[model samples]
Target chain A: MLRLNNIHAFYGHVHALRGVSLEVPKGKIISLLGGNGAGKSSTLNIISRLIQPKEGSYELEGTSMLRKSAGEMVKHGVIQCPENRRVFPLLTVEENLKIGAYIRKDKNIKSDMEKVFTYFPRLQERLQQKAGTLSGGEQQMLAIGRSLMGKPKLLLLDEPSLGIAPILVREIFKIIKEINDEGTAILLVEQNAHMAMEISDYSYILENGRVALEGNSKDLKDNDEVRKLYLGA
Target chain B: MQIIVSGLIFGCIYGLAALGLVLIYKTTDLVNFAQGEMAMVTTFVSFTFLSQFEMGYTTSFLLALLFAAVFGAIVHQGIMKRLQSAPPLNQLVVTLGLFMVFNGLAGLIWGHKPAGYPQAIKGDSIKMGSVFFTPNEIFVMGITLTLMLIFFVIFRYTKVGLAMRASAQDIKASQLMGIKVTNVFTATWAVGAILGGVAGMMTAPITFLDTHMMFDVLIMAFAAAVLGGFLSLPGAVVGGLIIGVFENLIAFYLSPELKLVYTFLLIIIVLYIRPQGIFGGTQSVKKV
Candidate 1:
């Protein structure tokens, strides 16, 4: 569903991603695993066009995303539920969800928002409450709800489990699987290796800005090397 | 006491002007140093309708506001849109350039000589014990206060206002949600420009219309906006009034020459103590 070929990303002089490439098929949960500064987040950012790649070609389905402005990208169905739950903390739960669907000019917004609230019942109960006041788990749910409102065909979720309680992490992973089951392809980046492998159909292990290994999740889970370094078996 | 009464009136006008600045800045994250200039130009448009077009005075004033909004939208689409993702410094310079352009345009169009626009409301200056106020000045304050009320209402009740705020907080995110972010930005500039125009038009009768009239008020309007915590509408209103009354009291008690110095000091002290102003919460700190 998505492809990045020879992508090179930089922050001034420091190279963040050095000639990296990856691909994903349609309607599948693809997990990118890495430690800090492994370019996992950077890959998601490049696909979402939040940060421009110094040199690379990215094709979503088939069209090159290079020529599109951020506003244009939303129409192409590559939306991001950014890390740190960058929900508009000052805005209410409803307002934050409305923001997720900003690029839509359709009259079906009310229905879309209803769908979001249905997916996240906590958001419905706290619709008027400020997002910042919500618990970390609740905010993560709201963030995912907000992205779902965008109705992206390919969603890039960045560390949705980060900073949330462990129990909440499992719940969030279950919801992500539900979202993937509903036909929206997902590119999930996570530090929680076990859950990512559990939910993702295909997984890529990233280290030092390059893909170190790629395989089916069950095989990766059974692999001794991954078990030793990442799984801690 | 006279200083206090008059201070309230002048403060209301400054508050409206500062509101204009804050609205544009909130969305674009741009200080818009040329905001005063935008006001100057729009008010001049009013000056044209009233003096040259021979239209009814009230009608001219209303038309001037419409003209200002349109002018603001044009400037946004043509100029500000290009600078949307540009660095703050570059955007700042663009507005500073606009400041010079608008001021220079005013000078070129109407010579450096200042002109006084006629007031619609006229009556004897009312005296209440130690205070004094003309009916027209009171009317001007009423107009400003009414505009502020309208702003509050629109911001609270309207979908457009909510969308505008959402866009300001997260432009890219808002865009994904199907909000035309460019339209929001344009609307902000339009509101800001119309406000500046009104301030210029109303204040022209109080302080003669000249290219530099708004310039003198720039620092204080900016100070008021910054002091308001840079994001809150109510904060801008309160901040502007505080600065206005304070400046007037200084002029009454001390010397007129020291008034600018006093307001300047107020700004520095406010920023030093609370860099976020009164309402703005710092989120993204741009890399220097």
Candidate 2:
């Protein structure tokens, strides 16, 4: 339900995103694949309004998000689970999750918190413990669970499995699929092409700040160039 | 024992001012070198309300706190906000500039002469075993402890408090969670200035209201914050008490004139042993 057209983002002298365009249809998991510095993170950051784009139109369900500030994005339900799991290191896990619901004024916050705990029982166990003390895998869970506390319509997952153990990575991907099935659209940025291809319904391959390839995940999986460059098959 | 009790009374005042410094530093990452001058100005404002306007002590104190809150918001919104993204050095210089400006302004408005200020409470010294305390000293410590408790509760239980803590920890992440970080910063300054104003009012009775009265307290407060590890609230209070007790011990055992020198030396030694301050964790270093 999100569309970014001809977006160009700059970081000082460097052109981080050059005329990049992509779309995430409602209730779908759209994976963007790229190597390091291929503008994957830049695309997510631009969508989250973390970095301003000098030229482009970003719309969520036909509503222009250009004027909306970064803090306003979450109110519109475009929540981002930022890269490196930016959990408040000093705050307790419960406190971190409570902050996730900062924009909500409804009384369902306690229920929403319970729902997050249902998804991540580990967070419940460490509710009072500081988030910085969490293991890498648990931190990832806390990050995602924290974002879910915002009741995101379009969840932006940035490297959720990065630096995580292989076993935990599988579990995380499983949760991603489960989250998608439950109707929240996901824009997942991943370097693990194999797991990405397996779960994503559609995929875009980014190279040098442009959309180099785009197709259905199954078709993209079988493409020779895609297999060679990303999947390493 | 008397020395310790008296030291703690002054320590509570130092801690009160340091709480503001730590709060502002935690939320905005700006070391407000001007905090002492700000407190001095607020004390002057209280004096104006008390004597010039013929207001009662309680009314004057509240009015001063209200003025401090508005003054803080104005300073942050009108000045500090402009330098939000500037280099830390530039920010430091700006606050130092504010220190000079506030100091000069206070002198221009109130004159340079020190004046007697009324205490919140008036009574003979209360004797407890070998220790004695004026009603004012007990009042200062009692109010400071109560304020600390209130601050801690608000920080722990409230949504705004959660947003504040979250923003302090990670501004970007808190924004992503829909916290209006600018509002948090504004609230931080307001609360910080209120705490600083309280320090000024409490100290004025003992030190007398003067443009330079808070100068010594500011240095000690900074030392206390550094000792407390800058990021920890409880650390700030404990650090203030440590500095107070240490200074008092030096004054009693050694030459009184050498107290400040020995206190600084002791701080250097303690910091050399624990660079992060007493409660500062490994996550982030203090900017100043």
Candidate 3:
């Protein structure tokens, strides 16, 4: 479980997150839906400790996380599948997965890798192939699979559906739901509002660095303003 | 045959020095202009151990390598680490600054005059057909080959090597994977400096130890790195060897004075044709 209180982040003179607050409950899929420059990615970045909020109380199950570095966040089981599948281009697919478990000293890494293969069988077929040579869909799978290798309790996914084909996007969303069903808390940032609302239990709509709307996914999906603005119904 | 053999011996030295430059550049994306000076200082350290402390040649050599490793780590932590977030031009300028500092310090302490340096193994040159190999030449080749083999194994098989490769390829992605990228970078600098120190020690006996001992070798090593494709480790070694033999051939058959000009011309032509060098990947032109 993760909680943010009045988090305000800045990029020089530009205030990116203006008094934004949110919560991700244990074993739940929480979607943060927003347009461009709405601070969706910034919120995910803050949770992952990639960017620090100038003003905020960030807590992971009651322990303050503001002091932790981005590298230390992974050790705390906060794995981020960053935007645009940033797999190491020169390294093999197998090496990319191994690097994900960089902080883990357990003997179960091989078994964990096997578990990832179950989620993305295509990756197993191309284990020795360089990651850069993978197709966008395959790269996305590798990115998600790589994060799973960390055995994260809290997964921060920033725009998993971006640039992905519609058919494969559905497949990835299906796997994302399955991952959440298995008990990992997910904070998904998405532009694909229809799919995100369909999968997520709770949703927050952000506009101009502020939370404009928050409700159960079902209620938000049926809301007239949400349908007109995001869902395009 | 003699020209090629001598060229190869010198090539091994350039390759060893180039290895350090390439390693640091690959991981940190900063071309260390001070690599030659670092090696120069380390050689001076070894000379002091041998002459002043009366240490054995082996002891002095190993101690110099150890000193290089620590010196490299300190340089990275103290200076390079601070410049990590700065612009690439700034980082490069800092290394150039370090070059002047190290060169000045070595001159101040060791004096400007060249000093005779002992070879690792002093013996008669062994003849094989038309070619003759000195004991020191053999030692240099053996050490270079061994270090190359060791580096190959480490890069291909070790965890640290994987981290280094990952970090080199994508720093942000490596961080997401929980890799201590700074530590990997620090390790690279340490290993790279050790390689440079080995090169300096080997080169000293042939050229004589002085503040400017590594100047020509460093330039040749740069040429080698460019020839091999700066990104590839094996490429740097191959590039060094090619430059060594080519330079020697030009000196023997053509004109020694024009060898440097020909070398650069050859590089310019190769780069003109391939752009990425021999071992480098084709440039990925990103869409704006």
Candidate 4:
């Protein structure tokens, strides 16, 4: 559903993503494993059109995303739940969800919101509370819930496990699997190798802005080098 | 006693005036330098309608408010939206162009001669022991306070108001969720123009209905905004009251000419110390 071929991204003078290439097939979880500053996030960001690709090509469902605006990507159902859980701090949980379906004029937003609440019943309880006050895990849930509100075909999740409790991390992984099972494709970037492999269909290991290894998530998890570097075996 | 009464009365007007800037800032993160002129322009629209059409003053005033709102929404969408992602300084430049354009347009359309608006309230004053307030002044204060309260309720309880607030806190996040960010900006500007229109209509009765009146109080109102910290609704009111009292006290007790200068000095000192007004919120910083 999403493809990136030789995509390079730069943050000012620093080369962040160097010719990263990948294809995420529809209705599967594709985990991108990399250390800090390995351009895993940048690769997902380019595909979501959050940041521009300095070189190479990024396509969403066969259409080139090189010149697409962030708003356009949102319209095409390419939603990014950016790292750090960038929820609208002042907005109520309900308002944040309402904003997610911002581009779609579809009248089914109300029912879609109900579906989101089913995934995150906690969010429903705090509908009036400001998003800023939510606990780290709750905020993560809100971010993911918000992306789902967009009715996205391909959701880019950048480190869903970051800053959350370990128990919640497992819960979040299960939710990710449930979401993928519901037919949406996912390109997930993570440093949590064990949890990622447990859920992902395919995986890619990135180093210094390039993809160093690509394989089935189960095969990569079994590999001694992959386990030692990523899983701390 | 008269001093406090006068302070309370004009403070209401100033608060109404500052509300426009506060609403715009909260939604768009950009300051509208032309806000004062925009209000003045809208007031002139009221003035023209009153004169050209024997439709009378009050009905024409309402029409002007609606027209100004339409004007504001158009400018916000057509002009400000294009420069939204541009640098802060560039956004300020667009407002500057708006300031000059609104000022020149008002002058050309309304002419230099001040039109005398029919008195909104009779020149009657109510005496409460040692203090007295004119009927018009009392009306102005009442209208401002009532509207502010109504506005607060709408913002706190209404869906659209919540959406506007959401857009202010984070545009990108709001956009992702399905909030039409463009319409939010337009709504903010439209509301801003309405507030500005109301303020001008209030001020016109006290001063001669002229474009230049906004020029004089613009700086004072702006100083009130800066002192209260931009984007703060209540802060603007408090700051305006403080400015009204402080400037009046300084001019009356100290020196009349130094009132304007002293008010700005207060703003500079305010900025030097708290930069953000008491109510102005600081965005959360995340270090990855």
Candidate 5:
């Protein structure tokens, strides 16, 4: 449901995204894989309207999103669980979740919160606890759960498994697949290429601010160059 | 006993003013050195309403608060907002600049001479055992307590307060949650200025309204904030009271002229003992 064409982004003199383009179809998990400084996070940031691209045509369905602010993107059902699990450290878990649904005026917030609890039952136990006190794994869970509270149509997850333990990482991946199965389209940025390709239907591997390869996830997994570079097989 | 009673009365004013400083500092991470000057200007506005328009004391007080709110919003939007991306040192320097501007403008408009300002309530001191409480003293303490209660309730129970606290803790995270952080900053300044204005109006009757009326109160307020822990609201109030009572005790038992010196000495001693202030957490140290 989201499309970007010829998007070029810059951070001062450094060009982060150099004529890069990608698409996330409705209800599909699209994995964007790359090494460091490959512009994976910058692409997600542009889609979330956190940082505007100097040159691009970005649209949700057909409406342009280039002019919308980050707050407006949330209202348009584009929720981003940013890198580093940026939960409000001083606020309680419950308060953080409430803030997630900040733009909504509906009465179903309580139910939506319960829905978040179903995805991360541990959060229910730590409802009154401050988010900073949560374990890295739990904080990651809270970040995703918080985004889910927005009832997003398009979810942008930037490195959900960055610092998570292997066991918890597997569980998080399982939950991510389940979330997509329930009908929210996801654009995932990941460094764990094996798990990303295993779960995703389509994949794009980026190198030096450009898309170097794009194909079916299964095909890319079998590709020799992908195996040597990203999979480390 | 009478000295302590009067100390507590003045303590309420200092506490209120300190709360204003702490509020802005907590939310914006900028210490408003101009807080006292802002309060001084607002007091002059109230004086204008009372004398020029011949308004009732209650009307003038409420109108002054309204004026304070607008003035605060203008300061934030017109000046502080532009400095958001600047370094913390630069932002602090701008507030110091604002201190001079407000003081200069108030002097130009109201003149430097101190003038008589009326009390909220006019009556004899009510006697309760050995301690005597003037109606104005009672009025100041009552208003301070009520405002404190209202502020606590809003911070703990309301969505707007939640937004403010969230924005204060993490601006980027708050923005991701769809909060308009800029609006939160504006609201914080408005409330902070209102608190300052309240302290100014309460003190004017006793000190007499002048361009520099808030000078002593501002210093004590700063001491109160530092003693309470810069990050803690309740600490500011408690610190103000302690400073207030202690200053009075020093003045009575020792020398009146050396009260300011004694108060700062006490603050330095307290900081040496507990650098975070009584209520401040270790998180404040992490920022440095």
Candidate 6:
């Protein structure tokens, strides 16, 4: 489980996250829904310790993560599949996947790698191929598969389906659900409300860097304001 | 044929030096204007070991290289690390500043006089039907080739190498995957410094050891790196060899004074015709 209590973050003169709070319970998919500039990515960045918060407390199962560095966050099993699938374009897919487990010293890395291949069989086919050469869909899969190589306890996905093909998006979401079912918690940020709500256990709708609404995904899907603004009902 | 053989021998030294520059630039995005000075200081450190401490050639050489590695790590951790997010221009200025510091420090410690540098090998030039090379030159070539091979193997097969490539391609993404990017940066500086140290040792025998000896070599090495595509390691070696041979041929046929002038002219032309150089990738290399 993870919690962000009354967090405030700023970028120079602009306020990004203003007294924002949220929770991600164990082995659950929690979607953070927002339009542009609603601080969706900032929340994830803070969680990953990429950017320091102006004021807040971040905890992972009661262990304070507020003072940890970005590099340390990954060892704590707080893995992030960053925005736009930032795979090492010049490296082979296999190399990229290996780098994902950079901090782990366990013998299960090879087996975990096989587990990733099972989720994205296409990745195994292009193991030796340069990641840059992969198609957008395949690159997204590589990005997620690479993160899975770290054996994330709490995975933060910025936008897994952005710029992806519709068919691939469906496949990716199906895998996301499967991954959660297998025990890893997920914090998904998306502009695609309908798709995200279909799989997320709970949802938070962010408006202007504030949580405007939060509830069970089903209830949020049927709520009048949530339906009007995000669900496009 | 004589000119070609000699040029290639010298080129190996230049290529080794350029490899250091390229390695540092590829990973940390720092041009390191101080590379020459850093090598010069390490060379002096070895000179002290050989002269003051009365150490053997092998011991002094190894000790200096070890010192260079630590020196590089210190430079990165103390200065370069802080400038990680600073503007490229600022980083450039900092390295240039270090160049001055190293130069002044070496001058104050070793004085301005150039000294005889003992070669790893001592013997007369071996002459064949058309080509001749001294034992030291052969030794230089052998060491350069060995180092290059070792680098290639480590880069291709090691976990650290994979992390380095990942860091070079995407620093933030590599961090997200749990890579201690700072560690990669430190390791890069250490390896680069060692290469520079080897280049310095090889060069001192020919040019004589002085605070400014590596300056001219550094210029040539940069030109070679630019020609080879700054991001490609093999490009650095090829670029160095080409520059070496080309400069030698020019000096043989044309005015000796015009050798460097012509080298610069050639570099300008290469950039004009193919801005990416011979092996440059489509993405413009980040200028250090």
**Looking at model 4 chain A, which ten-residue stretch has the lowest summed lDDT?**
A41-50
Docking class of 2: high
Please give, for residues B197-232, the per-residue lDDT of candidate 6 as tens digits.
Answer: 999998898899999999988999999999989988
Candidate 6 Cα outliers beyond 4 Å, as residue runs = B285-288
Candidate 5 residue A188 Cα shift, in angstroms, is 0.6
Off by over 4 Å in 1: A3-21, A51-66, A105-119, A207-210, B1-5, B70-101, B120-139, B170-183, B242-288
lDDT of 1 by residue, B37-124 (tens): 8888888888899778899878988898899899999999999899898988999999999999989988999889988878868889
Candidate 4 TM-score versus the reference: 0.79
Candidate that would win on lDDT: 5
- Report the C-alpha lDDT of model 5 over B5-118, residue by residue, as the tens digit: 899988999999999999999988989999999999999999999999999999999999999999999999999999998999999999999999999999999999999999
Per-candidate clash tally = 14, 0, 0, 9, 0, 1
Can you tell me the DockQ of model 3?
0.79
Best by TM-score: 5
Better of 1 and 5 by lDDT: 5
Worst 10 residues of 3 chain B by lDDT: B279-288
**Residues B38-71, model 3: lDDT tens digits:** 9999999999999999999999999999999999
Q: What is each predicted model's overall lDDT from 0 to 1? A: 0.84, 0.90, 0.92, 0.83, 0.93, 0.91
Off by over 4 Å in 2: B282-288
Worst 10 residues of 2 chain B by lDDT: B279-288
1 against 6, candidate with superior lDDT:
6
lDDT of 3: 0.92
Among all windows of 10 consecutive residues in model 5 chain B, the one with the lowest summed lDDT is B148-157
C-alpha DockQ of every model: 0.36, 0.81, 0.79, 0.42, 0.82, 0.86
